[model samples]
Target: MPVPTRKRSPFLTLLPWPERKALAEALRTETVGGLVLLAAAVIALVWANSPWSHSYETVRETHFGISALGLNLSVGHWTSDGLLTLFFLVAGVELKRELVVGELRTPAAAALPVVAAVCGMIVPAVLYVVVAGGGGGSLEGWAVPMATDIAFALAVLAVISTSLPSALRAFLLTLAVVDDLGAIFVIAVFFTSDLNILALLGALAGLVVFYILQRKRVRGWWWYVPLGVVTWGLMYNGGIHATVAGVAMGLILRATADDGTDGRKAEAMSPGDRTAHLLRPYSAAIAVPLFALFAAGVSVSLASLGDVFTRPEPLGVVLGLVVGKTLGIFCGTYLAARFTRARLNPDLSWADVFALSVLAGIGFTVALLIGELAFPDGAVAGHVKAAVLCGSLISAALAALLLKRRDRVYRRLCEVENRDDDADGIPDVYQQGQGEAK
Candidate 1:
């Protein structure tokens, strides 16, 4: 008797090799990046609490930049304001792809996550206000918990829930994109100081030119890099966060080439996709971890950790991130399914959704950004940063516990779905599902 041979799944075989490689490489990069980011955060925490804590503070406060250009900022500010743009640029590219060709392309498919993201933002802000008593100087920090660090959340998922459905990752990515957008809007509207209209107009003009070049299929880092720097510089000078320029550049680039193409596959390989593919690794592995190293280094002695719970602002941040995020995301998703045509994937249960929601509460990167902006004074900022770390840690622990408990079910489902019982290689389960969908 001849032995049965194993082959690729029909879905995997259908995709181009380069696309498949890129997808696989991206997942690996993000998983590795998440690990690196965690290590960086841990180092920062240790350094901040060590006997040499003053050295950490001194390094963070050291200034470096062109003072003539009004660009001199501390080490921490540079991390938060400058390096973080790369992260947002990748996010912008991802958001554009989702809007154009990915899960968010349709109204119904997009509605659930978008609504969930909105509620996720709103509820956290409301909770912050209520907990912190948003009257005197406390309301500024309300936006701190409204962010979900995509790298960190995805990292956690990659570590523990490898067998989970792809839709959950899609949902999380979409949620993070919308969450970042909300944070950007909040920063631009509320946190900006000394707006310079002329510089803003210049940034707009630069974006227009960049868009035109992208339409002409202008390739090479030489052309885009200089233009990107100019745009970022202008936006920074214009009193808008420099990171917004990153998003603008990402969004302006066409997701699909305008070659009068009819096929979906051809259009899928756009400048945006290529840019994201090339830049995502650096954004995840280097830029983000460095930023975390600089931004997350706050002295969290036992006393400060205790104070974080008692202080109104830090208390609000904790509640907003841990409780408000889970409540808001779960309720929003449930409401979307209940009222709209949108429904959860059959492979996912409400338990899975709740776990994902808790995972979304890991608001590390942008949460730190907002906390810095909200309380620029170093005295209080440290406590708030401690709160963010605490809250995010709690959320991650809960999410991991819940997801691990359900790993058996997901593993069984994965094996069943990928089971190729027939002598021929393709999984009958997937073929049948696709047939039913069609």
Candidate 2:
């Protein structure tokens, strides 16, 4: 006999508008993503140390490949080189969206973070270059600290509830987006070693074709997936980093079919609203989470710790991420605000700015990715991983402490001001009678 299936209740969805809005907003915020990443990190640590550690290592490193049509890569390489291209594509889409309509929409809105991101990227790279300048292998990992992992940084923010104002959170997010943009550019230009000119041309042609498809109102992403794979193959062979194919493909596909000046897609009824509605869920849910799971796992051990600190390349990375990131971000933002007419977030005091700067130093995910790219060999890679983890922890701690202190100060000031206002409101005769009674 067939069993009765439970009917899904539509009443479960009949909540008030405000409740629905709150739920949506909570989901959109970085909180859920942060929790997911934190869980992944914990799991990675556990897996690395457990008796099944060999299984974890074997699964991650075991070579799986598809060579049927001249394309070749191991399972780990495919995950990093192929799948991660999609991740970067999603990142590129978000960057474009932000610049076009979101937080980085205007020069004033974009300036402070752009400047800060530049400094943040430049200073750490310079620090790494300085520390590693004399060595033969050291120079290869210049881009190691030139990233801000949005997931890890946001996770740190999630843990420290009162350290940042809402506006400051917006500011950090913008800066991180800009930071990612810079890192993409760096990877495309610098890290690539070999050049397959014909493949490069093919990649460019694929982008053009994708652009035309977008212009013709192709909405289904599946249509472009094969072309994107071709683009990735071309880039992989073209001496450009394979991940760059993701960015290039994203730029073409995400171009809104809308007319820019009127802020509406001429073809769509609801203006910019419809386009955003379509892309938002895809970007936030599927793309970002898949990227996190694919990119986050790294083996941890007591022996690995010793190798991490003693190696110059990884040591430089740690210092650059911890020291360079905080100082560079703080100085860049502060200086930009001081010199320019860009208005500061009303809720953020100087103390809050400094705290946010420290939070910006949490560079775990992106830094680790860079380390992987910069050092493919196992020897120094372990050190780089250690540095990223240590630096991020230090930054998170410092930011949390500073933010908590600033919150306390703010509360005290508010209390004092409230007392003054109360005293002023009391009548002089009433006050004198009260004093006499006392």
Candidate 3:
């Protein structure tokens, strides 16, 4: 028997010169972002181990200040706490969009992922708590595994771009967004410190003002930027993690912004289109990649790995992120789909789900942030960083392999189905009948 080949679409081949060129440019932009991230990671690893390691640490940790503005923070802090706020703001806006009109718009569409996210969150934390024990303040890091860094996760998908189906990619993206929402809630509620009532009041007041402005249909971001900065400062002083301010501000701003419509009235948008149109490009093309470059640049050393495994907190974290994340996400998503009405991605098999779950174990960005919050100083923090890097790398590799295998099987099945349809001669039969009548 001859091997059946998939037919190419003539319409795609006959695209106008301009349209094809535009599409090529868009693809280049997307490709560049992934390349940038990979390049950054490679440089960071080399720089961290080089003799100029001190210079790298110094540059990251050196304090910079806007004295007139009363802002003082290390380069790392500025990136993580300040610049990364924009990253979270974009994330928050996306979350709100999804809840209002995207995949999470309806109970039926949203239930599977929400249930999966809840299970994904609860199971990992439970595993971390169990493994670390209930005492010694070790349980503080419970929320670490709850997050899914969408950029890094997507980057992993890009590595095996040819193998994974679009449906699987969409499923993972939605799941990661849901996962991020859970992580944000966990951070806001659990990781907070002693409240400074005055600062808390100031932050709340700032939020209210932003909300009012949004209701007034403010179109420009300039109006909100200063308020957002103040809100972050107040939240920082208020004993809440400052990043929450970004999320809060983004939600209010997006809720209020006028989505361009029929040039008549502004209230006609379905919320998702408005928010996504406003934030998608900025988020994907700029904010996210910048955050990855800054956040993923941890110092690496051969000695650090040996010391990292010796500490309990780091060991627990590494184990939780790699082992706990894979098991929890796969088991949770699988059980929910099996037992409930929520449908799994039509193109994905059990093997595909398991593989994507392993990729979920790549908890680099969020894990690093959580480590910073969980252990401010001491040997624990060092170990946690090492474990996060090591475990994330391992999970990413394993997941990629699994996904490649699953993709081969999935493609074969699709080919078989297509062949069966062609054999049935439905198209040829219809064409022949039409010709005879003519």
Candidate 4:
């Protein structure tokens, strides 16, 4: 007799137990953070439009930081430039894990999301340029709509999806992580200020020292924490976004537990894992939400709302996020699977993939940040922020509708699957009827 063989699912195979556990924990934290971020954005919008709008402006303008380090910035700038680093750091950790040990460890597994994410970004920028680049309209905001807010997307998924396969969640998270990396690269490459060579070199030196400490297995918060601040300040002064510093540090840290280099016992967790675990709650609950509070305080009115559609730049943002993101991701995934060795998961249909692509359109946090970077002037920036809010809200609503419908289908399938006429315990309806017939 021949031995029985097991077949595997295509594209996204079930992750190992350890990886699944890690992914689950990260998703939960991000979901809660998404809710908090939403709340903060809501408060900001309300306060900015309310009778106390002047007070809101005052608070956002208040400045305080280490003056000697060239760190003093307005509250709004601090939130965008400083607190947002925590969010990016968490993003960096997620990328490190996925690349090193998670779904992205293999090229086949990574290709699906990677292809989709790349298309997702390119289409948005192309669409933005098409819509906004007419009559020498500035192409500065081309990259604004290229990100997916992981927290908000995951949070919306949690609410709408039940009984869906875990693979779907993993796929979405991986795609968003790739999307985030692209956004970070755009920020680093395109949105820089005048270069300060000395400050940039100093920042690079600090990163080298930080990397060395990690390699030497130096484990002390006191030693690295201050160094991190110095590095961030230098990077900020060095004409690059300070958030780059956080990601740089995160990537430099080891993602896997290692044997003791010196005469010491091996630790159970790697420094990267330990830091991500310790900081994720703060990043999700406090850092991101606080940033959203300051960043999302765009005043809303009939004129501002109308400008989102009438103005070329803001209009481009809206169309890029909603239309471009949906088509790019769906089409790109199909192309990859068709041309390459990748295959669609047996558990998912094209409709489900379409819905997932639509969900990727919620580019809340990073879109607004890029909007500020692109349109620094007050009036245009305000309009662009409004456009981001509008685009994300529209995407969320569409995704929610599609996801809820799919969740119901999956729920029905689950019921049929679990209904067993032959089980020993509490017989199914079929068995009860058959017994009566007998």
Per-model TM values vs. the true structure: 0.86, 0.79, 0.81, 0.89
**Superposition error at 26 for model 1 (Å):** 7.6
Tens-digit per-residue lDDT, 302-398, candidate 1: 7898888888889899999999999999999999899889887776789888998999899999999889888988677888899899999999999
Question: In model 2, which residue pairs have backbone atoms overlapping below 3 Å?
Answer: 194-239
Report lDDT (Cα) of residue 370, candidate 4. 90
Q: Write the per-residue lDDT of candidate 2 for residues 367-413, one digit (tens) a residue.
A: 77777788887767767776787777788788878877877787777
Residue-by-residue lDDT tens digits, candidate 4, 341-437:
9987777788888999999999999998898899888687898899999999999999999999989899987677576533555547566788999
lDDT of each: 0.85, 0.72, 0.71, 0.89
Q: How well is each residue in 232-323 modelled by candidate 3, as lDDT tens digits?
A: 89888787888888778766655333555646345666333465455545555555555555455555566777755655566667777778
Winner on lDDT (2 vs 4): 4
Q: Name the runs in model 4 displaced over 4 angstroms.
A: 1-28, 259-264, 421-438
Q: Is 1 or 3 the stronger prediction by TM-score?
A: 1
What C-alpha lDDT does candidate 4 achieve relative to the native structure? 0.89
Lowest-sum lDDT 10-residue window in model 3: 24-33
The reply for model 3, stretches above 4 Å from the true place, is: 1-34, 134-137, 255-299, 417-438
Alpha-carbon deviation at 174 in model 4, angstroms: 0.9
